[model samples]
Target: MEAKDDPAIIGDSEFTALLNAARQQDPEAMLQLIELFKADILRLSKVIYMPEEDVVSEIVLEFLEFVQQGKE
Candidate 1:
């Protein structure tokens, strides 16, 4: 995992705030959330034999859609 992804690097409350902010369409928060999960994303992508960039894009798109749905 990347240094930023390490749970110990951030407090639980802070992480929760980050997640909430991302759901609100805060770009920086979304990017931070992506950084936090990037290692797992890459690992999953490798298992499916797809390109890493494509997997990343797909996941981000799906996440954004999920957030949008929550607002409806």
Candidate 2:
């Protein structure tokens, strides 16, 4: 496991494994994935939406809906 405040990590395989583990609901993996993508997701949410700003919760919910719908 990584330190709680390790700040940054760099490695494709490590990140890929982290993502895979997150899909399995490993808490640490989830946290890591969130930490990694939170900024990116927010940026994407902003770009995809209208002039109205998006809150964090809304961004997450929108992303969830998009992903869920895509899986169907």
lDDT of 2 by residue, 1-72 (tens): 665765666588997687666566567876676677676666676666554355666766664444334421
What stretches of model 1 exceed 4 Å from their correct place?
Answer: 1-9, 67-72
Listed in order, each prediction's TM-score against the native is 0.69, 0.50
> Each prediction's Cα lDDT score?
0.74, 0.62
User: Quick one: RMSD of model 1?
Assistant: 3.8
Between which residue pairs do clashes occur in model 2?
none
Output the worst ten-in-a-row residue range by lDDT, candidate 2: 63-72
In Å, residue 8's CA in model 1 sits off its true spot by 7.1
> Which candidate has the highest TM-score of all?
1
